[model samples]
Target: MKKLILPILLTICVIAISCQQKEKQNSIPKMVNSDGSYETVPLEKDTLVLKLIQNSVRNVKKIENAKEVVNENLQKVKNLVVEACTTGDKPNIVLMHEFPLTGYLYGGRKDKVQMALQIPGEETSELCALAKQYDTYIIFGSYAIDPEWPDHILSLTTVIGRDGEILKKIWKPRNIKRFYSSFEITTTTVESVREKFIEKYGIEEELPVLRTEYGNIALSTVQLDPFIFSAFTMKGAEIILRTSTLFFESDIIYTAMANNVYSAMANIPADSPYGGNSMVVAPSGKVMARLDKTTEGVLEAKIPIAKFRENRKLPQYAIELTKDIFKQYQEEIPANHLDMPKEKLPQNGKEMKVLLDSLSTWLNQ
Candidate 1:
């Protein structure tokens, strides 16, 4: 009888421990909603983690030397990624600043072409290897030469997947034609370049969203238009990554809030006076983490997918206003239009002033 009692007591203890473990497993923390209501939000299967690298360019004498510079910079990026992985907070996506391979330059088209890389060429292959090594998606920008036009070079932003695949490559629609024109570079004409871009890459009427494990991400340049952001959001983009030579804080914030999505901006150091302020903005349009304007470093942020979804459902005044404006001009506005005038663009400072005065007159009229 004593032996039976001992066995029964041990069994009861085991059952009690199993129940406590099950209860703990079922319990989850409650989250407060915007309306002050507490509710249990289920944990997401995956979190959207990101790292934006704000790099600085090292001046080199010749374009040929740019390759070495690029390799060194890439090594730095790899080191940072490895460190992040070691810390057990590895980022799922890493964004690089504009002109990561070769810094922005104004020179003869032929000279620039010599420095330009071919898409899926040697440079991008190395980037792919890096992406595979870290098992993270990488988005980087470079000046690339289209195979169709060996003499012409286009600015490109490419997305590399964790499997070392080229997911998407986008040609920058807007380039610094004004500076190129100043040098009498014939290949840099706005109309001619636009035609070449359209011939190779289709007209970018809508932003491209990359569907990934984290979320749908869109890549844009510094020349992003407000309408582009709206178009992306409408297409179900949850995060927009902007790689730029310059930082526009107000525009980034407005885009995040209006679209109710995360916005990450990666800019280079102020070595060329155009780089500064690499940052990540939350769905609420709040700056989450930012690198110093002059510093060259990596900024990482862990964005909650659940929170983004919640904020997206909230009422956004900008979106409401946009809808009202669209309704008012529903019939007047054309489906697609380019506002560029028939007249040639200004070629010099004096001509620019005259053109501005003419534009002002036209607007006032």
Candidate 2:
């Protein structure tokens, strides 16, 4: 009876979320987008453990054998996965921080493109092997390139499913580019190439929610963007998985509480002045498990998914009330500014700043 009811409830939950989106649309969503959500297989068990890797950051700019370094980083990750998954209770999901393989390379678009790895290339093949070996989901953020979007460097969080399949490729939603005075983030994101992205992948892919057997997980690299995070939750994300190079502890906690979803942030653990803590937070904004700042390790946490979903539903933000203000609001710099020809793309942070200034509505005004 319990088994039967759980399946029914899962179906109802998916419908409830899909129906809410359908209510807003006049026509049915395309087959590519599915019934307004990218659905996955049913839950395998009630309890799920997540292991967040707070690993060391190593930039490959100076390394001569960058290819070897990529494999070396992967080997380190393999060891970590073997260490964590084999000992004690195995984790259902293993998460890694931003730039684990190639790390942060300084350059213009050409250099960045040269440094980035292809998503389905030799590297992800190795990641798929691990996911298949352990029968778990393996997710990590990397600097990637796509043959479809030639010469463009991408900040992508890739999800590998249980059967060694590339489940979803989550592009960094938007970069906090204007904040820094000296330079700009040159990575191509959803906002950077909004028109082209929408034309190719559809709008739903902009803030995609991956419905998985473990839970409704949304992969992201966006930070300090309340609108982006809330929108994901409203799209039915039960758990938000994030990768970061920096820390804003308040940003993680507040977003979880306000959005009403479990949030886990995996950050780089380095012996430096800029080390941030990797943590998992509850909907109540309580820290469930965390690694000490600058520590190299896996921060493990358990989620009782079945119990958490008993009365859970998608969050309903006051969208109608604030829709008018949002419509009126204008951002300082216009998007698609970076969506230029490959040769014309800004090469470095300084060059990006110069290009952005000319395209900035605020500065020009």
* TM-scores of all candidate predictions against the true structure: 0.68, 0.87
Q: Across residues 169-206, which tens digit of lDDT does each residue of candidate 2 receive?
A: 99998899778989988888999999899889988899
For 1-365, candidate 1 gives per-residue lDDT tens digits of 98799899999999999999888656522221345222223433457778888877653336777678767766776675566545647878889887776676545444666766778987678778878988888888876777665455556689998999998886554433234332322222223345444545544422456666677677877453676676666656778888887766788888888777888888887844345778889878889998877887678898887655553442343656577777765322122112233235333335534443444434445
TM-score of 1: 0.68
What is the TM-score of candidate 2?
0.87
Instruction: Please list the C-alpha lDDT of all candidates, in the order they appear.
Output: 0.66, 0.83
Residue 242, model 2: lDDT of 93
Clashes (N, CA, C under 3 Å) per candidate: 0, 2
Off by over 4 Å in 2: 1-41, 271-274
Worst window of 10 by summed lDDT in candidate 2: 30-39
